[model samples]
Target: MIVYSNTISGFNHDVDQGIIAEKVHNELNQKGFYNSINEIRSWENSLFYMKNVLYSPSINQDLNIAIEYNIPNTSKRVDFLISGYTYTENPIVLIIELKQWEKAERTSREDIVTTYLGGSNRAVTHPSYQAYSYAKTISNFNSYIGDNNIEIKPSAYLHNYKEEYRSELENDLYTPIIKKAPIFLKKDTIKLREFISSNVKKSDQGKLLYEIDHGKIRPSKALQDAISSMLSGNDEFYMIDEQKVVFSTVKTLVEKAIINEEKYTILVEGGPGTGKSVVAINLLAEFRHKIVNYVTKNSAPRSVYFDILRKDKYSLNYIKNLFKGSGSYFNSSKNEYDLLIVDEAHRLNEKSGLFANMGENQIKEIINASKVSVFFIDEDQIVTTKDFGSINEIKKQAKELGSMIFYGEDYNLTSQFRCNGSDGYLAFLDDLLQIRDTANYDGFDGDYDIKLYTSPTEMKEDLKKLNEINNKSRIVSGYTFDWVSKSNNDIDVFDIELKDDFKAKWNFSNTQTWAIDKDSFDQVGCIHTSQGLEFDYVGVIIGKDLVYRDNKVITDYTKRAKTDQSLKGIKKNNNFVLADKIIRNTYRTLMTRGQKGCYIYCEDENLSKYIEFRLNKVLKKNN
Candidate 1:
């Protein structure tokens, strides 16, 4: 597909927008390294270990070089250079051809689809394929030289050269595997590699896959870790022993009820690792809320929001305009909303304004915005950040809103169910990082809510083991917060294909076909797609970039940013806090997505430390 660089208006051209044009040009010019002929030559020379005979003047090499360097012979500057030789002294040793790299302009629709799907649309061709084609062409180029050298007419030699080049091209480009020796072979070596390289320049599968895993291919700092964790299968949630359930069983059940609930001003008190943002989105879907506005304490959370908007079938631009009151994308009788949900509500306090003079506190504005308001809070997660909303403060706001009191359901989902259910690590986290808290379940004797595993490889192995226990009943899958780097007609390339099979497997038989780079209905899974939807099991990927050193303990973004008073300091720490919030929110979302249990993959060493620290505290208290 033709990817148009950001455009400049006619006015810009008339007014000498040279600087802007230069900027645009620079950005567009930044294609992959192998997209040019100059790059191929540079790369070939850099290989440093090729056979010297190929470059030497051994078998009629002079004639071959002369043909390539000849003037006025520009027949599309033939990329394929083939030479064959039967030296009287060397005994017809070799035949060689070469293929030169060219910045290929995408020529077909299929090219766009594959690149977009595979998430490498930015890269013109897979590096491996490019290398192989170049080698094949090079080999074929050498086949043109034979012993009859002087006796053979120029026409016959030229015909041989063309045939050799064409033969190699056909085999390398169309065959599944290279039958003849193709000096280079491209093979996938990592996860998702096979899927990405399945098709050739026929499709933009790389970019598409990148979008599917993350919202955009190159995510901002806000979602860097989350996206990485998700793609790598590093985020998950587990159950603590009877004593602690951070995303405890009770909390999960309660969340399910709230999502299923049609009426009421619901309040959720989620512990750390209990997915509050995920629950909010699910609840929005269940209730069919007209406007689902999500606000979080960090840039990561905002990135999460973007992921959901872009991945889901809902038109993001339409949704964005809904807030503007200018578009006709959606219509509703009520001016306010059917329901209002706030995640990380603890991060919003008396100083934050929600609406016109509703109150400085966010809770007040939330209550005013809808008939039924759902506030998901965690006082501990707030961690002394400025404008931190306390549970007590929320209770007061609820009273002022005149909403009937609903029993607060606390989450104990602290099973540390990731890293192969490592309880030791979980216990370590609770003891080291969290503020001490008690639960009534502590009195009972039972399994440690936390678990431990050797490493990520073991974690995946354990998942296979768990799946074996009950394959149909317990579906083990993952969630990612990846980014989409390319777009087709303003639609995300990743969310375009809503797999009929994936939907059917998930029991969404009625789900419509959603285009990967176009707005479609089945985008919600993790942060990229799961904006206004829910799932039975959700896996979250939390990374270390989200954590910052604060008093030897990892702190959330709200605590770091809002608590800092100096404007300069806040700006300086903006990235740090934003990173923290996104990671934290990712955990919150994953924890809540599960109606039964959540899985986690946390590659960030710091996140693992934090999880271990929390689990340790829970274990110590139980002991």
Candidate 2:
């Protein structure tokens, strides 16, 4: 997928004649690729300088050159790649990251530099570190790199920076990365050419580039071992009988579609804790040979999964390609992926971009991107207005696209695996919350622990005790509290205030692994952070947004926090019923996150009494 590839002699000729940028742009346009005018301008500037550096008499003109080489199964592309051989005839590739930054400032974090980008001063990866990571990702994922015993050399060339700014780019914090992949500034053009010439002494006539582009891709042995070790002895990875049935059915469908070269959309519908994520991960691990990816809209579960799978540094570089956000397929090629297992499909956004003006429907894009698209959805989990991933909508889109949709008992997971396999508990919850009617409205017979708390402090104390035993318990709340800074220096201020001096901070935004971080137990996670995740025990704080009024659950959109983006403008909408439904759905999803037990603290006294009445008098009467 290289946008431009040719012999070094040909590239030099094109660049020397000042037509290289136009040639690359014409090729990209012909391929239906999207690139902004600003990006093309940067490419022209960088390539013009690159031509000067590679035009040295010592550099071999017959070497292979490629620009904008697309990384397989990913949205990223390398800036430039040169393939040749050293004097010993060993294959070598020089991965160059070209930057046009005239100035950059060191950030508080290592390997991160701040520069003016996208109309604002933003933190971006240091060029050298970026190049090194790109090279490492290729080495870890590309089978050809290992099979051919190729040597990869990564470097960054900042052609617009002055010599005095070199100190900032070569800071002590970035010493290790710079040692591995040196940074070349405008003054270091001669040195950069010398480094390039030193590595590539002979030309391979572009054979190496062709092999890399056309090589068979498989998970590296190290990656396979890492995944196996992560899944081994993990009880959560084990699937139940119903789960196994669904897994077998979906796998067979995917295989059949691939064999027949046909398109199929398999929808797996289940409520919370029906093992959707468990089945999705198992499918991902088993279907390594096929071009499969796990897609989700929420970052919390995806980040937690990545953290759990790639505990070591070696696996982290390659694991990211396996997981993608739902929006990543907006401009993807048709039928590019063999299988796309979309987890938490209910969270898929309608559109992407900062203003949500870019791209068309994500559902259509996902369906168009893959031959066999398997979507695991929970209709009740549509917590936001933008989420349009209903089973009906998916079916409609699939029909419009001329793809067959398969959903029935074979696709529905009935057996509950969470809350200690307490199906009655879920039924009782549905009835008590008035989200829907259930047979267990009056009583629930289950071993799962459920309790209502009079105070938030008591619920926190109980959660602490539970966490001490298993370390898989935390307090989560409705988005009712405003996250405000108490002092200029303290950003993680106590946001959730309660009586008896009980106060806690909202979960840290930077802690993507909040569910697993031991220190995060004290912070209260909102719905966005807790969705698609499970814990041994959960403490839920029902906020003022929901109340029990006139024997029916009522929703007050005004009670929701101003900081909560999901609930924004719901109060202004004319559809009160829809708003209430979304609010109830949010609470239901929160309460069901606990695998074995759930403790509750409600802000509304009337709601608390109603919950108790259902657990006690109503249940006893029904019995």
Candidate 3:
């Protein structure tokens, strides 16, 4: 996935002609990327600065070079990569994160710094950590590096930064990452050159680069399997990028809170498959020495986690106490808990309790009751009217409680560990669902499988076949049916009755662990039973609530089952627009639950046709 690769001599020639930026842009265009003027100009300047560093004849001119090399299975790309052999003739790759920051300011938070970027002073990841993360991601997922013992050296080059203020970025808070990935300033030409020439001794003639480009990337571990293994002491998950930075940063903050009696609130925002739950569970495991609880408003994920731990034969009392509802903090005394790791924070309601009347606010109560509170939330994934979580809401609560707030890259998760690690898939989904106006989204670029079936029975049969490999594929639908089987004594009663004799019951009557239950795939799951969970593959049934009419996507609240609480009070407010969004978002969440693939069926033929058409166009573009 290296968009542009050449020897140092060839790269220098392009730059000497002042056409390196044009060449890079052309390479990117061939791969369906359109860079803005600013990015193009930055590439030009960064390459010029790199030219100075590589001018020494002591450096091998035959060293392999790459620009904008896309990480396998992920949409993220490294700015520059150099491949060669070390002095000992071992395969090595050097990752360089190019930056143009003239200055930066330190924040109270670890792993975060504020700098002028994108025309504003913004909180961003420290250059050192960013570079280290790029290397870590490659080593972890791209098994070629790990299996072949390829050493990766990561560093950041701030060619525009002055030497006088190096201490600002070299703060003690960032010492750990800086040690792993050093930072070079504008005036450190000799230093940077020495760093390169010291490691890269011999050229590989692109052999190492070819293996890197064609190497196998390990598939993402099944979410349920990973969580279950995590519950044991195995720790089968690896945190990458912000997941790593966020983990270390929060660990430090939690230590401060426990040792110094400091109160802090961290707000971590990320979309689906950003490994939110994985990170939350990692924290729960790390701080088990202290009184800690994994809190969430969703019972589906909790049930699945509890089941996973139960299989390990953890004590029943420990399981119950470890996985708690958001409502559990309503009546706790101040700082009663050492740490609160809240997942699905977007589903937290304003009030706590069965009837939503116990607490002033769930966010406020959690902060009040814990020495340190960590919230993992995604507002767009808020599928119900009851969801009260948002970036603004958490900050407001933290401020009101006089708690130190940790935001920005230090607390956010950005890497996509699902949907085959294709950010384009999520962007294409947003465009298809009309959730936002996404530009240039043809399709996702990954090995993720997406299929549209005209027949519901066909979808189920295929998905059921997939589930046979591992009990990790199941069918979920919008809340478009009632639980008739729950009320009937007849075991034959079905809750979901589709045309063409497609009949099934909801996972409601099944065990709480429907997500991983062996026979549960025979039943259908609603948004409640599937949210905050994932599968190897999923079959989604888009009901009559959503359809294509007159060349536009439409939602009909009346078509939804009356028992569904997702849009309960929205109709009363005549919030048709809001209801429409919920319906679309509900499906979006369901479609994305599959890690490897997704199968879809629509009740409306016209809707099916429209979706098939859109999917075909994307497939063609990707091909």
Candidate 4:
């Protein structure tokens, strides 16, 4: 007899016959990867755990199982099997009805176990529970007699099935006793729950079930062990727990690369605070390797090497001679390091493709440049609003390229180490990315180190105060009228006020005071002047042009990028939607750079409200 396995294959088509309840289920089915029951369970568990993992790592739910006693004169046995890990002294983890294919409904609507599944058992007599019990019994009977058998129907033996097991559970007389049982232990119980609750899915059902039963399922012990090892000891540098190490999986993998000292290619994926950049730094330090070539989309070209310079830690002059290009200039020994670490690799897009404008994949260049290649891929961190920046495509590229090479693999850093020590932002981020992620915001304080000030006068006062603390380090700048060096005029006011005095106030005329000019502030530039760059403190000036027009949706990104105009025969155009997306992304990047603080100036109330809403939501809920 065929047992209906949860791991259904080739079942992506809509099966209106109670396959799944709604459009959401259909959407999940179409994703192709959600083929197995285990996968479905994992998706739900991950979403649930994501809500509390960071904020309440110790939180746990106690599962209970109880069976009703039935008493009468006859010594009859009505067996109802309780599945899951049966405990000797503890409550049953899961109670399941054992029904043969001969019967359709296993339990009646009055069965107490129906309400005990996902909901609490406190209200067993609730209307919902009663309905479930009755419906289940009927369903169980139908399943056994003739479910999906077309011609056969249950009307044939309807009387014989219902009368037999009716008294076993309904009355309060039959005493329960354990017959045979496995060793009941706490760790094993937790492990069992975690195992059965694993999210990984397999295409085949029989094999999957067997695998689960035999303990061959899950995130391998190796991965968990690695996470456990790193998290065992608390770090003096950072206040964190064992679970926090999951967030640094990327760091661990990179450190492994350094120790192995062998040619390897790795793709690390995660949301913010996953420690991609910091891990890169530590990896380079551990290997004593010189950084020859560096590429980034959102990081400031100058600040790309900020950590090393700030600490005077290591020399990476070898990069000067590795390649020849507009920004290629480094000095170091021959073959200084055979490792290439690309930060924000998701930003490497089609426009940035290598092959000297031949449209060859640029990532291939990085892979070929070093014996070992490491990429920090975060599609959520695409700040430049460029078309080519996507981590999803990068994974595909890596797989396709790896097929041509000898070895290639990818890993996801599970925990979010940055964006504060909490997981709220990570939860929201998962939802934003449309992944089934759940997280809690308990005890989270939604406050940022940076403050948003729309008033220019208030901004100036704040910047002055911030600068007083560390003028050389803290930068105060805004977009300028003429930051676009290629433009014919110094400034193009597409939509804002402040154009009349933006550059002059920043003393742009004197190159030493402003970093935008090659001849001037080689280290510091105003916000507009520092496009594509970041700093310790970025004070953004949202000029008056930012307004919510009645029909204008600044989020509509229909314009060709500054780099894309050459490919398509179209001049640069500013669609509000695209502009809004770019602006938001830019702000996110800018705000995140400050190790300490950030400030924003936008007179527009709607835009301010939006910014405050997002920022506050992340900060307050993510603790």
Candidates in order have lDDT scores of: 0.33, 0.79, 0.85, 0.35
Looking at model 2, the pairs that clash are none
Q: Which runs of model 3 end up more than 4 angstroms from their true locations?
A: 106-108, 171-175, 228-253, 259-262, 355-360, 390-415, 444-448, 488-492, 497-501, 570-575
Question: At residue 163, what lDDT does model 4 achieve?
Answer: 39
How many collisions per candidate?
Answer: 127, 0, 0, 58
Error of 1 at 615 (Å): 11
Per-residue lDDT of model 2, residues 1-623, tens digit only: 67899987799899888888888898765543546789889988999999999987899988899999765433357899999999899999999999998888875554666788667775566788778767876776579999889998999999999777788888897899899999999999999999999999999989888888877754212121234454443322334334655666667667777888788998998888777877887778767567888899888887877876776553765567788888888889988888899999988888976678878988998999888888999988888777778888889889988778988655677656677556666777888888889877665544466889888998899889888875689999988888764232274457889875678888855588788886889889988999988887899999999999998888897798877777656657776777788889999999988876889989999999988887675435433
| Candidate of highest TM-score | 3
Model 1, span 55-82: residue lDDT tens: 3222222222111110010001112222
| 261-306: candidate 4 lDDT, tens digit per residue | 5345566665555455545444443333444334454333333233
Distance from true position, residue 207, model 4, in Å? 57
Order the numbered candidates by TM-score, best leading: 3, 2, 4, 1
- lDDT ranking, high to low: 3, 2, 4, 1
- Which model, 1 or 4, shows the larger lDDT? 4
Winner on TM-score between 1 and 4 is 4
Q: Output the better candidate (3/4) by lDDT.
A: 3
Evaluated against the true structure, the overall lDDT of model 2 is 0.79
Q: With candidate 4 superimposed using the best TM-score fit, by how many Å does residue 526's alpha carbon deviate from the native?
A: 7.0
